[model samples]
Target: MTSESSPTIGLPAGDDVFPVLPLRDIVVFPHMIVPLFVGREKSIRALEEVMRADKQILLATQQNPSEDEPTPESIFTVGTLASVLQLLKLPDGTVKVLVEGVSRAEILRYTANENYYEAHARRIADNVGDQVEVEALARSVVAEFENYVKLNKKISPEVVGAVTQLDDYSKVADTVASHLAIKIPEKQAILALPTVVERLERVLGMMESEISVLQVEKRIRSRVKRQMEKTQREYYLNEQMKAIQKELGDSEDGKDELAELEEKINKTKLSKEAREKAQNELKKLRQMSPMSAEATVVRNYLDWLLGIPWGKKSKVRNDLNYAQEVLDADHFGLEKVKDRIVEYLAVQSRASKIRGPILCLVGPPGVGKTSLGKSIAKATGREFVRMSLGGVRDEAEIRGHRRTYIGSMPGKVIQSMRKAKKSNPLFLLDEIDKLGMDFRGDPSSALLEVLDPEQNQSFNDHYLEVDYDLSSVMFVTTANTLNIPPPLMDRMEIIRIAGYTEDEKSDTSRLYLVPNILMEHALEAKEFSVDDEALKTVIRRYTREAGVRNLERELATLARKSVKELILAKKKSIKVSPKNLEDFLG
Candidate 1:
């Protein structure tokens, strides 16, 4: 409807009374046309009253859109006077009305009406303050509104052409404000402004802010679109390359490698749990790119899994006499240790399936504790592997680090087993008492699972993520003192290796140390000789130790001096005696 026709039909002969319509979410500005869906009873009544009489309604925004029936205080004082152009009553008991805003109006008072809300209000004329300032703001707001329409695809471009053609600045400001996607309170504040310059300025500021936000949103959309396209392009190229390689028969190497691993997985005698885990990891490896880092980690895990001696075992020497002979030939005077080892061999010979005993040899430093482990391995004919637990503090050092960690691997236990190359090896854990605890974890606690006969049959490594059989492997631990943790101490049978007696040390020097020192010095037994009294004097005077380690050092020194004496004196033989022992030794 035209502006002149709407004002003439709304109020006749200075009557300010009009039907009041409370809008829920919109603030209607003058010169703006909008469609309203009237659902509330009072709203439908107000629309019907205006359609029947003057087709005029005072449209005010509700303070709270959630309010079903708004009181006078809930409605804004200033509103737009709108003329109803068309009204359609639907079967759902709602009226759809098309209304054209005519002018701004101020509510004077509410009139008593039984059917619907009626309000006495007067039209509010626009105040044009300083034509120059109003003209400047209108131009800036129009420019910004055009930019907003371009950035925001929701607004029609035709609206910008319609706004620029309007000669009245007040109408231009109201037209721009109506099209803006701003909140109700902000639009209401713009409608409440009396001066055209003030309304245009407020609209300009809001348009600029909206334009800035839209520009940022546009940039983000462009960036995300580019990233998605790049990812899709790379994926397509990789798939095409794979297809080309397959057609040319160039992908057979990778296929052959995977097939070989699959064959190994089938042939190698892995336990039930371990075989299942290997198959699952291999499936994942097949799906992943060969060049990817994650694929390498999975491949390394499979290598470790396949590298373990699953069913391979060395033949355990069953002869007790041979074991005793080997033990006696290696060590001098540890009769008790040798006897225990021979007993173990004897029992293993008779039993069908025997789990190796966990032996902890407690002794002083340099008392042949470490050497005894080697001797036992030799006598039993099992592969020997030694892992020192002197300063091991991380539990990972024993149980292995998880595969999630970078550069992670199986713990010392699993690593040693891999090196042993046999399922049943003599695994010696040296310095068991020196196992340390820290924040990473307690190595001693981790060893509990390794030493327990009941639990160690299915020893689990973190990186391997599979159970390994340790039932056949013999574990020997040596410590300087019995200062081991009680839990660890409980798992193994303790064998105390006491210091050697004076006589035992003398015999050990005469028999073991002297021969080894002569062989090392390149001197034969005929050329260099030490009498029993001279050896006793050297042991009693020069060295004072519980073990034969110091006596060995003293004997080595005498061998070196004997070599020097034979070279200078041109003598065929050099005899070290107690009479001239200080002359040679000092």
Candidate 2:
């Protein structure tokens, strides 16, 4: 097919095949050329497979597997089928290949034996016969691309023109569309369009949108730069004033300042990590002769570190009776679960008690799963930190993104501790069962360390890449169901918070619900309060849930509506009865 009259010969044309190339942001069409740099282990293996195969490899978009596995998907049903024109291995362990798109194809199942993801492809219809205004579309698209090129930062107009005059309109659109800075999903949409006119129109719309976004981004960057410049100048002025004042100091004045600082430093107890950071800052002050406001900024940070509550542990009264009292103060039922929490606190009374027993509350929504964790924290006089695991599919989020990635952060465990402003506090991991599996990574596997007490004491997040002490921290987890991983599930003590029985609901409402509802609905002391019969009527007639929570809401509703009427009608208050339930509700 090389150095021939036509890209594909009509004489005894070989059986048509499509190689499902899975490259992103770059689409190659027949008579359209694109270059790819392959270096990853997957890419290298893919190259090797293609070099060895008798027929060309079909490039395809990856498909996800039904089961949880590391494999990617097959190519999109509509993709450019291409042949590798040339292949050369670079010194940097990358394969340099020139590939030209050939025809449209549908991807079959993944091929075996590949370093890169490859799919078996069968050709779709050749060049469409019913094209009407495709050639005019190509010219108009070319002009649009030329304008797009001039608009792109630093892109050469000559390069754009060369791409435009190429033989295939489909290839031109694909090549230009690939580099348009459109979102991946939008690019996939363009790839999926079946016809030349459709593909061209989609690409044009996407390109225009990309240009608009670029314009907005340029304005945003300029505005930010101006703001930063103003801030830096202000900082420079403040530090210059401080330095000038210090320069006018006497020997004894310096001594006095040093003495005050030394006294504070002596009083300051520091963590090993924070102390080391402060010491480094002091050394920086000793060094770096061409100092600026940034240097002064570092010195200020040192001062803050000296003043911070490092090596400070909050006072926690570890009495089981006290914890029980706190729990009873707010919640009415869940007697069994509350008792277990008290037992946990009793065990904490041991001098050498192992970190806390990881307690997971399994129950339905509004069963006070989150509120209960807060109550436990209040009972122990410790701070509570919550990490919601719902919709957390990225492994980076659960385990922290790798620090090498831009804006990487510590996993939820490390982040929660930092947020609580304490190394040891009560951590509530919510919705542990709702983690999703995706190409980014499985969040469940990422939770392996944070939930495991043995491993969690030295939990390492990918972003922080530092092992944090989670041993002394008490961890609580909540889920609607016990659908958590077996290994993770085994590590925690499961406390079942059953739906309240009808009798329990009625009793709990009488004590906790009535009073709380009165306070929340702003009802006066003399307001017609919710009586036993009225509350019972409302609960039986209005709603039915396992938890008294909904019943409590209904009670609150009665108070709110009646309170409004009490203020409006001067008939101070009406006694709530089964017959008068409609007055409050309606």
Candidate 3:
């Protein structure tokens, strides 16, 4: 092979033995020249040995580039026999050298060397076939490569000139293949081909693929350039209009809104840490344009900051007698439940900082499990909000969806506080036993933190991403059965409200249900009176249930039936007796 700037060197003869220098991420083909920077000690030693001896090295590529010192087996068996054309030592303790591939060689065996690897290799000459076919393949490869160079201008123009000048079919194939932008594996495949025809065919296929990729990349770059130009034009136009408006004293630019928000943030009583966070976010919002995406996110963040109650707490009434009176007035025949609530109130009165227990009311339907939450809220003079958690399946429903998800908002616990407009309010999570589970997540498990008074003080909603104080909030849960999970049940103090007896129902009907139903039906109380015997008859024969719900319905029916008589015949006073009750009831 002819050399440039250095003396020409011929191919090795007989069983040629040469020092092996492994390459990474590059393949060297016969008639192709390349420069390598040797950094590894073993590779540097191998290069120095080649320059001192025959100035010829077995330049092969390693399978893995990361291997600092590769064994003989880790390198490709078929490689280039290259001559050291020129050598230069750099200041970084490394040597750089130019080499030209002489011929294809196959390693027979690795020789034992202390510093680096040495292998005995045999030269493999190209088996040239019919001259006409080889010329045709070389011409096809050159045509495709020229087209590739046009699409991708990063390749040097000199490579195309050198390829066009070569007439030897084998040399033209190797020259174009080495310059193509392909990976080492594909290049190695071409180097391993025995005939010039095979190498030319493989190089043509690879260049076609590279050309297709370059066209796609060109289209993407063009699209990006157009978008950038459009954005630049719009930006300049907006800047000019803003300047003109400002010169005419006609620019508001959200100044009044920004000033008003700033005043509210300073005047509002927020925690020191929360106040500082809001100020930093507000500064970012002030710096951004209203049309920018970040401006909306910053505005939402500030809204949450200013909207929360922060340090505001509802007033708690801890009077035990008043609380008992409230319980008895709102509900009937729940003495045990009332006693537990009064005891909690008494404890709260003694210690101002004591947290309320998570009280779960277990009973049948219409037994006032939900109403008890309202009575407790009224008795304590705090706001009341009830969240029916019947078929809740996702934990996110309770703890809130993260803000990253679209349409995400605060959870039921946080939403209740916002609805009540207080940090501490009465939260009734009704129908706890009816909670469901699905692939989304288990919601009952999320109640673990909310029910625990200690952890609830720092309950962090995924959407809020802030610790909301819930220690002072009274959480009263209700369920019809004890089907709740063990971990969740362990957190609350379960109170059982058994069904009322026959006599208890009779008296409740007289004191609360009868009077309330009479007023609801718009019947005058003084005109019609339902006797105890008639009420007992209705309980025994007409309706049967654990609670006073059916008994109340029967009384409403009686009031409506008597109202018909009062409206039609002007009958003012009518007493319902057990003997004549069926006539009115039926």
Candidate 4:
């Protein structure tokens, strides 16, 4: 409930407000100043609101503002009450505003009236002392912060003098830490630190540690910056590529470069099987626009054809040790499912570095299916993504809605592929059995080419119109039942996800679930105890499901019912008992 620290020289008159722009990775304290360029209509309007309102605003960050409409979510309980100090309108129709943060405020979410952002907030109450008295720590922190500034990339050391004159120590420390020219997640971690002291300590530690290994740090920074710049350049180039592709009209059926290649291969004296394979590749390529990323991927893919030793494989051992270790580390039980996956990997090791068969795990709800998929990804060192097909009936859901449809997409498969940013991923198609067919189209039938290994190597999604090699993708599907289409089911190796046995549930209760339940309720385990018999009774009498669905609900309910009584007993300086379960359960 304390206020955020500010950065401007003098305290903000106890009332002058500032607009807190809550970006994903930036955290500014009450006494900290954040500079933002306002160009987008939404951001411009934000600045206009502050300027029109005399620079008073709740500058809070949000995950998604547009979706919630008008109200951009206020991230943390603590945020700066910033005020507009200076405003400049640029010739390019952009506004530059310098806002002064006054105090910290606790925002209770947001409520919007118009197209801008608004929130209900109360001032944060930080009782930390001023910086002048803590000279040693301040000197050490500031000095370390100066070094942090120097070591970082894209940041000039000249900014240090201005930083030292910064009013709030915490704000200064966090600001330097924020703009440390570090990774987004690293910056986010610094911003998310609760106390200025903690932030200073954490940042100083990283700075001191990294500075000692200065060469390594510099090398890493240089490499990362180069990679990032390269990626941005490539992304822009790709956009331009798309525009050019659009300028070129459609390729007539069987008349593109790929089609001609197919004709040549067909006329050659190749075997029927070889001819068919090359023909499929050509057809897929012809369908793909040359300038598209998919076409680029396909073109590059043809290079492998000249080189792959036909059946050469890697040295992945069939031993169950690594897989077992990973599975046991992340999950409690489901040994059968784990064993099957390990076996699949073992069998796949014999193949020429191609994908293992797609696995669709079918089980009742809440049997840790999704988590298991993640663990498998971790085990195989592959990225993981989940695409739910529960209510999608359109063929476009599996393939993609054609771009001609106005708001077109490159299919869930393509999106997932993009998300992983890799050719190979442990793609989890969740709730496959739940996928339904309605007026749009049967999405499951469309998934046929995607899941079918025979055709998925050249999977031609409708929107992409390009045959993407889904063959490299180690796809996994999860279903609550075995009622999935036989064609779809046939393509996958099914792993039955059974409910946790009572003993397994007991282990989870003691190990993972109960501790989390206590932490969430903001209570210690010592506040209350459940007898082994009571736990058994709760599991058997109150809940009956193959999954831990009801078990989670019951634990939550038990914690809620006991919390008030536990608090009352604590106030009285006494103990509470298991008999208290009745009030909660009832």
Predicted candidate 4 versus true structure: per-residue lDDT over 1-586, tens digit per residue = 1223432233323432334455443445565666755666666677787778764677665544333332343355456677777778899998776766666666665554344555566664433354443334556767876776666656677677866776556666655675565554555465555555656667777677767777686888889999999989977875675566666764343245564565556455433444465566665675556766676555543322212222122233344677789888777788888888788877775776455567888888878899888987777777788899888888887787664565555678877776675567778888988888888888888888887777887777565454556676677889888988888887778888878999988787777778888899887767755767778777887888888878888987777767876677654221323465555675
lDDT digits (tens) for residues 346-403 of candidate 3 = 8777876656567899999877788888998999998899999998999999999887
Model 2 C-alpha lDDT per residue in residues 1-586, reported as the tens digit of each score: 0112232321232344323346654444444567887656676676676678845656554343222223544335556666778999988878888877666566655656444566555565433223445666666777778777766876767768677667666666677776676665566677667666777777877777767877787899899999999989978975675576567652344335445655565566655665565566655544333245555555454554453334455567787778888898878778888988888778876745355557899998767889899999999888889999998888888776663554444566666666777656778999988878789987887677776767876666665443555666778999989998887887888998877766777778777777777787777657756667777777677867766667767777777778777788877776788778887775
- Candidate numbers, best lDDT first, in rank order: 1, 3, 2, 4
TM for candidate 1 is 0.55
Ranking by TM-score: 1, 3, 2, 4
Deviation from native of the Cα of residue 208 in model 1, angstroms = 72
* True-structure lDDT of candidate 3: 0.82
Can you tell me which runs of candidate 4 are displaced by over 4 Å?
Answer: 1-319, 354-356, 566-578
Least accurate 10 contiguous residues by lDDT in model 3: 1-10
> Lowest-scoring 10 consecutive residues by lDDT in candidate 1?
1-10
**Top TM-score prediction, candidate number:** 1
TM-score of 2: 0.49
Winner by TM-score between candidate 3 and candidate 2: 3
lDDT of each: 0.86, 0.68, 0.82, 0.66
Query: What are the RMSDs of all candidates, in order?
Result: 17.7, 30.9, 18.0, 37.6
**Which model is ahead, 2 or 3, in terms of lDDT?**
3
Please give, for residues 208-230, the per-residue lDDT of candidate 1 as tens digits: 88888999999999999999999
Pairs of residues clashing in candidate 1: 400-411
